[model samples]
Target: MLSETPRTRHRRIKENGRTDPADLHAVLAAGQVAHLGVVVDGHPMVVPTVYGHDHERIFLHGSVASRSLAGRGEVCVTVTVFDGLVLARSVFEHGVNYRSAMIYGVPRAVTDPGDLLYGLRLLTEHAAPGQWDYARRPSKKELAATRLLALPLAEASVKISDGFPDDGDGPDAALGLWAGRLPAVAAWGTPEPDPRLAAGIEPPPHIAGRAGAALHPRRPPPG
Candidate 1:
């Protein structure tokens, strides 16, 4: 349940609007890539890029040489997941059920040296858990050339849909047209080490495991 406030109600959409903060957080955490919508030079642009979330805020990184991050004012970010395909009796009524989160806020460049390093670590870990420790940390020069942006999740909305289609009553149902849901999921493939890797260099545990095992399946069990 959400606080009974005008702002919350304003963002609420019938059936689609999700008021549970935990649900929203889960969806955000489940995703690795986010599409950032921003107004650049008065033109709207949506860029797909990797992101990391630290419970309270979302971190987005870009090359310091990239203009998208250098000249941004306020940015609108959206993360989404397609759950399944909803097939209805009528073609016009067919649709896909999905979960999505929209965040609207101003992005401030991370300036503090300590916070910058921490944010970078969070970003790195978000993409590859345990990789931060396994790989060399960024040097001062590398850090200097990286741009990190943090956006608070305080003002955001989650929309989700599950189950089958909603076809009109009477004639639609009587027509006996097939109606059901086709589930969709994401899976990871087996780990393939670099050909140049030393013969003794084994895959790290984190790398050996699938990224989205819960959503998908592990490697076709070893023969």
Candidate 2:
């Protein structure tokens, strides 16, 4: 089951390096933003952008005129969802409880009209479920102005660290300072309806119901 390649080998904190593909998907799904790293015109650039993914590929969208998005070379995309703060007895022992993924590949530009719209819909829904259905679909001019990139998940790395502070048996434990994890669960807050919306319109149920919902999967699915 190991898909370990030289580029994805876990070197430090090997135990925290995850090999389960499901873990990679979960981290990406839970995260709304990803860092896309690319080299354009012999200069390196890393940009933060929203992303969406299906079983095999990640979809990124931006302005069609964006220079970085036009680059069709090797790129590294990373997504991380922080779960908690590992507060240990000593400064050196402090760490973070998180799940992260790094995907490597040369992204393919999505230009087909139908496929472009499909990918944009998926990306929109990833951050705001039901938004695509609720709002007006993109028009021809809008579609022409957007650029979409699809990166395959064939080569990637996943890592997770979600344990109690590792200071129980260490000398720092004698310091008597508190040592435990301070969990950080992301939750949706009250939705602020757009001021320009029609007076009678209300926040749809799909968006309204997510208020205060936990973003991470606390456990594995049942059989």
Candidate 3:
């Protein structure tokens, strides 16, 4: 576990802050999207974009002309996954169960063709397992039009909240209201065939295998 730094230090809700590197990795991996914050001219802009993470770095993808991909000096990225809802007897005590990570660093733009292709493949595979191999590879023109940014994970912060209502022993407990967690889960719906598909074509195993699979994160309880 890492100690607090000036940027990552936990001042408020110190108990909810986590500094373990593994915890940070879990949160980032579980999220399918991230918000990238950048400065354009004298203004601040944050855009929601899909992301993928390796043990060392996080990759952000978008169009080459995208305003968010101005390739500025510094950037901030955040990823969050909601696990469940914590309903307490009192409205004020109600909270959400979630895991979140914030990364701050100067993102390096990937220009080399090989590296850019690899990063794009990672991004695709992160969202859908076995997708990169099953789908058509990007053409050279498509690759040229896309932009990929890589940010180191060296400076990051992780926070997670997963617990019963904190008001268990408080005055609200006397209200005799229901209090517990309502887990949040996600699953893919049935695959819809393309309108122009050949009549005899069937779904591939890679797509069929995800039927009824749990889309929830593999994260453990709060640290």
Candidate 4:
């Protein structure tokens, strides 16, 4: 279950709040990037990074020298997927359609050799499926230079906005104006291989197969 602390509560737009822990998982699974927020020397900082998560925790990593990961205090990670734009007759009613999740927790640095490799595998697979097995694993020196943090998924807040403009039922409807959702969806393009690659080398099936697929795909139903 998702924890509902004051930090995770939806005080204003309560109607859009989601309480199900599964919703948070779905949001995280669909998105590729996350904004990691932390405080450094009494100042706030937010750094965008790639993340991976399982049923209980999220994995975030960066260079060991990165200031964003130097903080030992609380951290907030947010993932947002913009679905579209909700245009209304009135400018005041214009809004966007999106799915977002915010997680709050103190992250613990991953140090154990086995755990570090496991977390790195999750991060790599989450960003590019099948790449871990296809590419060489990280060497010892590379692993030592990296810093991975694991945060519990126990405390999170999720909100989804999928509705059309509410002004349709109000006086704004009288205006002779067009109003609808302009969806912003992302699709993968053809793969561009490295120019220095050996001749005749082609993209693998997994990489080539993603062309034209949605970046944030709908979660398939479980069997």
Please tell me which predicted candidate would have the highest TM-score against the true structure.
4
lDDT of 3 at 15: 88
Candidate 2 is scored at a TM of 0.93
lDDT of 3 by residue, 1-223 (tens): 7545688887778788998888888887678899999998889999999977777888899999998887888898999899899999988889899988888889999999888877887798888878999889999898889899999988888889988899999888898889999989987777789999999998888788777776656854222
**Candidate 3: lDDT of 142?**
89
- Relative to the true structure, candidate 1 reaches a TM of 0.87
Candidate order by decreasing TM-score: 4, 2, 3, 1
CA-lDDT, candidates in order: 0.75, 0.85, 0.85, 0.90
Backbone clash pairs for candidate 1 read: none
The best candidate in terms of lDDT: 4
Clashing pairs in 2: none
Instruction: Give per-model CA RMSD.
Output: 5.1, 2.2, 2.7, 1.5
Cα lDDT of model 2 by residue, 46-119, tens digit:
98988888878899888988887884889999998898999889888899998889999899999898888888
lDDT of 1 at 201: 91
Order of candidates by lDDT, top first? 4, 3, 2, 1
Please provide TM-scores, in order, for all candidate models, with all chains considered together.
0.87, 0.93, 0.92, 0.97
Better of 3 and 4 by TM-score: 4
What tens-digit string does per-residue lDDT give for candidate 4 at 171-192? 9899989999999989999999
